[model samples]
Target: MATSTLSRWFHGNVGMVTSVIAAIAIIAIFQIINPFFLSPQGRVTLVYAMSYFLIVACGLTFVIMIGSFDFSVVSMLKLGAIICALYIDDLGLMVIPLALLACTAMGFINGLLFAKFKVPSFLATLGMSMVIEGIALYLSRGFLHIISNRAFRSIAVTFIAGLPSIFYWALAIWGVCIFIALATPFGRQIYAIGGNPTAASLCGINVVKKRIYVFMLSGFLSGLAGILYMAQFGGGSIEMGADMSIPLFASVIAGGTSLAGGTGGPQRTILGVILITWTQAGMSMNAIGHDIQLVVFALIAIGMSILTANRKTMSIVK
Candidate 1:
């Protein structure tokens, strides 16, 4: 009885437990290597640097939890930034909403292609990525478009309690997501659909509609992240979102959200984001090259995937 009870508890809480331990371990190691790793400035920089990615991961967490993938997250981010830059002069503060609306539209199209046309989520998102990238390149003309709007730039630079304003944005978004995921019927339905779509449909869940909403949310967050990125950097470029897949996916997976779905939430992704951010910060402080950092991220992702692989749900991943 004791063994059985212990086993059940461990299995139920493995993701959270492991992530917590891993995060603590990483922080400890890094702090040892550089005594300043936990200093006030360093902590603020780490959170500020990770704010946008954290926001994106929060949105992606929903999509992943529903047993689907959104490959266009990075592209959507780039598109949003480009759109914001293109119209910032004319729209001023309104540019943010307009850009987000565009991204939401793009996500809706992705969902429509998947849920209505029977296209696989992977392929639908992949194709959308290409479309977004093409649009971004054309609009930017293969050059960086500087953001001249002071009000828009202030969004990224404004600090509250010594942390970037974007950090608060990330926190607020995550809070809402957590509430939705834990306290609402919609959240439960997402897990049900992910765990078994046919069964969820039989139980009267609107699988298709929910899936579309998931993608729309993902797109909205991606767009928000893009705007934040532009504000932080003072410009938008076609390459702004290049090669973001690894870190974003890694953060989700490492945080305990399985690609197989139905197993994680926004809270887990928060831990994952912090871990990845800390690792990257440590590497940068240690003078590690960007290429080597990518390798580190890839390896961490692979290891986490292997650790979290749910053999029983392997068939459901498709």
Candidate 2:
């Protein structure tokens, strides 16, 4: 009877349990392989790596939870970073709004294309990414832009307690996402829509509006990530966030937020973020090359997708 109860609990909380196990195992393996992994400096490096990533992944969690995709998340982040780098000297604090507004607009377009025109979410966001990428490249002239603004840099780099300010920002945002997902009426609507769009619409949930708003929320968070990233690094370029797409997707899925929708939330993403970032950190400490890391990330993304994307409703979302 005890065995049966444990099995039932495991099945019911599979995502949570799996994510916890994977996160713990990753920490253990990395700590052993690179004794520096738990060292003070190594811990700082790990936090920085995951902080910006967690900010962006929070947005992806919302979209994925609703059985949708947003490939433009990374591109918009890049664009936001580039915008800040290019205009920080001129706009100072105001450039933030400009960057955020641009990202939000792009996200709105994504929503319109997918919900209004019936474009596949993946295809719609992919196409939007192309356009955003072009704009970013043109703005930066395919060159890296340095940001020398000490005030701007302080936004993310200033140490607070034992960690950087960006770490706190990421943590704060994660908490907000959790609250939004688990508490608000809007949150319930998100799960309802993801679980059954037709029923949600019939039940007065305003599926199209909710979708557009969700995409907009995604855009907003992605932009916030970009701004924070630019501040933390003191520079930006078109390539800044280019390779992040797969990792962020994997992080969200591995966190057990089902791509099938309505099964997970940001609460799980923190563990997945820790797991993936530490793996990368461990690999880097061992002198792993970029090529190897990309390959590994791709495999992880595929594996996680298989585990989380289990419902036919996922296919119908487009």
Runs of candidate 1 exceeding 4 Å displacement: 1-6
* lDDT per residue (tens digit) for residues 53-102 in model 2: 99899999999888889999999999889999999999999999999999
Every candidate's CA RMSD: 1.5, 1.5
TM-score of 1: 0.96
- What are the per-residue Cα lDDT tens digits for candidate 1 across 104-203? 9999998899888888888999999999999889888988799878889889889888878888888898999999898999999999988888899999
Clashes of 1: 0
Determine the C-alpha RMSD for candidate 2 after optimal superposition of all C-alphas.
1.5
Assess every candidate by TM-score.
Answer: 0.96, 0.96
Kindly report which residue pairs in candidate 1 clash with one another.
none
Model 2 stretches with alpha carbons more than 4 Å out: 1-6
Instruction: Score each candidate by Cα lDDT.
Output: 0.88, 0.88
